[model samples]
Target chain A: MIRKIFVIFAIAGLIMMLLPLVVNFEYKDSLNELSSQYVRGSIDDLKSQNVVTSVIVSYRGLDTLGEVTVLFLATAGVGFLLKHKKNKNSLRKASELLQTSSSFLVALIILFGIYIFVHGHLTPGGGFQGGVIIASAFLLMILSDINLKFNHLILHLVESFSGAFYVVVGLIGLLLGIGFLNINIVPLGNFGQLFSAGAIPIVYSLIGLKVGAELTAILNTMGGEQ
Target chain B: MTLTIIIILGVIMIAAAFGAIYFNKLLAAIVSAGVISLLASVIYLVLGSPDVAMTEATIGSGLTTIIFLFALNKVRKENKK
Candidate 1:
C-alpha cells in the first residue's frame, strides 16, 4: 500500500543519509589521534571557560561558522512560516493576572538570559543556549493570550543587524588568514573568566541575540489561532 | 561489544516503533517514534556527541510530536460526521 511505499522510501532516505557516517569511519582513528594532542594545547592556551565553546570558536571555528549559517537559514525559513497578516486584534486579550505573571517572568528570564550570554565565555553555556532561553520567555508571552503584538520592525532591525555583525566578525578572521571565525586576532583573555576568548564570546552574544529574536518571531508568527 | 549493544538496542527501538505504527492509534505510533528517537539519541551520546543527541531528542521527538498533533486535529475534523 501507500504506507509500505512510504516506509521503503524512508528507509532509502535514511541509508543515503547514513552513508557519510560510514564513509567517515576511515578517517576516524587518524582524526582522533590528531585531536588528542590538540586538545591538550587548547586547554593550556585558551584556558577556556567551556571546552565546547573553545573547540567551537577556536579549533573548529570554520565549522562553527557554517553551523551558524545553517541556523541563520533555518531561522529565516521559519520566519516565513510565521509571517504576519497584520491584524492588531489577531490574538485575544490577556487577563490582568496573566499579564502580571508574564511580565514578571519575561523580565526575570531576560535578565537571567543576559547573564548567561555574557558569562558564556566563562561558563558552560554559550549564546545559543541563552538565546533559546530568551526565545522561550517570549514564547511564554505569546502563550499568555496577550493582545500585545511584537513590533516586526524592531525584530527585523535586530535580526538583520546581528546577522551582519556575525559576518563582520568572520571577516576579521579572514583578515587574519585564518579563514572565517578565527578568534586569534583578538587577544585571548585569561583562561576560565568572563571577557575572555576575545571576539568569540562577542560573536556568540550576537548569535544569541539574533537567535532569540528569530525564534521568538517564529513562535509568535505561529500564533494560537493559526 | 559496544557496537553490538548499540545495534541491539537500536533494533529494539525500531521494532517498538514499528509496533506502534502497526496499531490503529495515531497517538500510540507517535509516542513510540518519540521513544525510538530518544534511544537512538542516547547512542549518539555514547559516541561522544551530546549536542547532536540533544538536537535529535528535541527536534526528532519534540517538534515532531507538535506537528503530528496539529495534523491529527486536522484529520479528526475532516472525519467529523
Candidate 2:
C-alpha cells in the first residue's frame, strides 16, 4: 500500500512539474539564425536539396564518422558475445508463403535501399536508413532459412573497404586544402541533380555500404551462420 | 484534422507502452514495444521529419524487434536443451 501510494505521488508530482511546460510551450513560427544559415548554406553552397543530409554528411561529417565507429563497436561486441555454433539438426522449414514472398521481396528491398543512399542528398532517406533496409533483406533471408551460410569473407571485405574509403575521401578533402570531409572535393554540379551534391552522395554511399555490411555481419553472427 | 490524428496516435502509443509493461508474455511485450516505435515513426512523419521517421521505423521498430525475437528464440532453445 505504501509502495503504491509512493508510485501515485511520484506520478502526480512528475505530471505537476511537466504540465506547466507543456501548457506554456511556445511554438516557433520561424527558423532561428543558425537554422536559416544552415538552410542557406545547404542550398547555395552544397547544392543539396536535402538540408538534413548536407548537415549530416558534410558539416558534421566527423560526428557521423564517430557514430559509424560506435555502430562498428556495437557490432563487434555483439559478435564477440554470441558464439557461432552450428546447429547440426535442421529446424522445421519456414512456411512456403514466407519463403516465396521473401525471395521475391529481397531484391526489391535491396534496390530500394540502394536508391535511398544514392539519392540521399535529394531525398528524405539517407545512408543509415538505407543500410538498415538492406540489413532487413538479409534478415528476411535468415528468417526463411535457418541453415543458410553467409560468406564472412565477402561481408568483412565490404565492411572494411567501405570504412577505409570513407576516411580516404575525407583525407582527400583535407589534402585539397578544403576542410576535412568538405563536399567541394569535386564539382558541385547543377543544383538538385543526382550528382550535384559533390562528395555528399559518395560519402553517404560509402556509409550505407559500410553500415549495411556491418549490420549483416551482426545478423549473421547472431543467426549462427559461419 | 492533423491535431486529431496526432492526439489519437499519442493515445495509442501510451496504451502500447502500458501494454508492454502489463503483458506477461515476453513476445507480446516485445510486440507492444514495436507498436510504440512504429507509431512514433508515424508521429515523426506527421511532424514533417521524414528522415527521422524512416530511421525510427526501420531501426527502432523493424530491426530492434527482429533482434529481440532472435534473442528470445536463442534463450528458449537453450532452456529446452
Q: Can you list each candidate's DockQ?
A: 0.21, 0.80
State candidate 1's TM-score: 0.69
Q: True contacts preserved, each candidate?
A: 0.00, 0.68
Could you say which candidate leads in TM-score?
Answer: 2
Scored against the native two-chain complex, candidate 1 gets a DockQ of 0.21
TM-score of each: 0.69, 0.94
Interface RMSD per candidate (angstroms): 3.7, 0.8
The whole-model C-alpha lDDT of candidate 2 against the native structure comes to 0.92
lDDT of 1 by residue, A1-226 (tens): 9999999999999999999988887543455766765666567776565666767767776676677678768767865764544433433477788777987899899887777677776765667767777876877777676565688899889888998888888898798797677677678878766767667678778878987887676566554343
Candidate 2 at A60: error in angstroms? Answer: 1.0
What are the runs in model 2 whose C-alpha is more than 4 Å off? Answer: A1-20, A84-90
RMSD score of candidate 2 (Å): 2.0
